[model samples]
Target: MSTTQSDRLRELLEPLVAAKDLDLEEIEVSRAGRRRMLRIVVDSEEGVELDACAEVSRAISEKLDESDAMGDEEYVLEVSSPGADRPLTEHRHYVRAVGRLVKLTLTDDAELIARILVVDEAGLDLEVPGVKGRKPTARRVEFADIAKARIEVEFNRKDQNEEDVTDEKEEEA
Candidate 1:
């Protein structure tokens, strides 16, 4: 897609995303035969549910229908969540995944499973467990070296408690 189209799409979708309490992870426009495809990926703090996706899909469809953003051509509008395996694209994505385990492949073809300790202007600081007699090491990797990374979901009661506390704080604030 051209930069102009991408920018225009972002302008049109930002408000919709905020109104729906969703993060606009990506917007892709591609040609599929005679029709164009507009794919919108959204996510929420607790993960996006099917109903939420439907709602956003409906809203976006309406907006597109009303605005003629895709011109006179026919188009398909799809709204969905960026699944569990979605790459961490934005700094906010990394922030949201903090304290969660992630598998990242570095540029050197080395893979590491570590808890995201911190995210700063530089990049991600990860904590990887060490071998016997060796101290755990922390690596500060520039975002560029991170070829691929995804959160590792684990069923743990402690995580539930932490989420609850976070929810309470959000409510209070």
Candidate 2:
């Protein structure tokens, strides 16, 4: 609820999370009817697994149980990875979104939908989709110029596996 409480929780849990090679993305404390909900979002470049969440949950639960940081309030601890729609706020977020389609909103309020091609310390290289059989064009956006960015869900995403299979079929032919 308060910044102090959130900071305390971060102080208590960051090391435990980092020990498992995960980044503590967020700490949210909210009221759910009678009890408090402590939602902790953790992630790694390789992705978070169910087992990893369970492990982190167990560790954090034990630490909270031992410490009086929760102040006797009943709280539900939820450990999870940032979902597909999570905003791309960090450089690593952009790095992870490479090869995925994203909706980018500039600080000036301009918007563009492009596929990520590269990620560097300063900016990103994107392939802007073309219309009417036109070739896609490359564009670079400095990170400082972005207001918000999120991955666009693609149900039929063409990953490298499918392309490899197609190439194998062609070779067989």
**Most TM-score-accurate candidate:** 2
* Residue-level lDDT tens digits of model 2 in 1-173: 55688999999999999999999999999999999999999999999999999999999999999999899878889999999888898999999899999999999999999999999999999999898999999999999999999999889888899999999999999
- Candidate with best lDDT: 2
Candidate 1 lDDT by residue in tens digits, 7-99: 888898789988999988888999989899989899887889999999989988888788867789888888889876668778888888887
Clashing pairs in 2: none
Q: Count the backbone clashes (under 3 Å) in each candidate.
A: 0, 0
* Residue 86 in model 1: lDDT: 69
> Among all windows of ten consecutive residues in candidate 1, which has the lowest summed lDDT?
151-160
Overall local distance difference test of candidate 1: 0.84
Residue pairs with backbone overlap in model 1 = none
Compared with the true structure, model 2 gives a TM-score of 0.94
Off by over 4 Å in 2: 1-3
